[model samples]
Target: MTGSTNIMIRKLIRSLEKQKKPLWKTVAEKLQTPSRKRWYINLYKIEKYTKPGDIVIVPGKVLGIGNLTHEVTVVALDFSKSAKEKILKAGGKVMSLYDFDKLDLKGKNVRLMKQ
Candidate 1:
């Protein structure tokens, strides 16, 4: 990951720590490679850590490198072409991170993380 991305990831981790009941959890074991090179988020982790109606954020970009079975909404900063299609096909919704901030998160279980 780039320095800026690392900083953002740290910020997210800190934010998650403050919540009494975090909307989601990070369950994957650490990989040997750095984060940026592994642009794709793990669908299994998302499914395991989040529930329906949770919004997932990817600070960089999302790649269509995995299968998604959960029906949660994904609001990322950006997404690959195939990622968008797969999300929609799986009956999930997709939105830009910018649009997600405009909505009210009150009483909602939303997960904002860098994936």
Candidate 2:
């Protein structure tokens, strides 16, 4: 990860420190991992596992390998250009982790997608 990404992770960790949900703690731990060990998920995999209104959090990146069949909110550290376009085309919303953190979702319907 880059220096800015490291800073973002630190901020996210600190913000989630007070949460009681194990899911948030787990997400924080995942974010703390080295970049090489982070996840890279495809759209088809997300589509397969998610419902229309779910929020999917990817700690690494989202790639444009397939299609999304429904509208879901995707939150991640980064997204490939085509991934963003495809998501928007499918009427889904893309969000950065920082913006996602500000929403204070409290882990409701937050799916942590991985490869």
lDDT for each residue of candidate 2 in 20-94, tens digit (9 for 90 to 100): 877677777777777788889999899899998888988789999999978999998889999999999999999
Superposition TM-score, candidate 1 onto the true structure: 0.57
Instruction: Give lDDT for model 2.
Output: 0.82
Specify the poorest-scoring 10-residue window by lDDT in model 1: 24-33
Residue 19's lDDT within candidate 1 is 47
Give per-residue CA lDDT, model 1, range 1-115, as digits (tens). Answer: 4333455555544554454543323311121125555345655556667777777765446677777776878876468898888878878888864453354556657765544
Candidate 1 Cα errors over 4 Å, as ranges: 1-40
Model 1 clash pairs are none
Clashing pairs in 2: none
TM-score of each: 0.57, 0.83
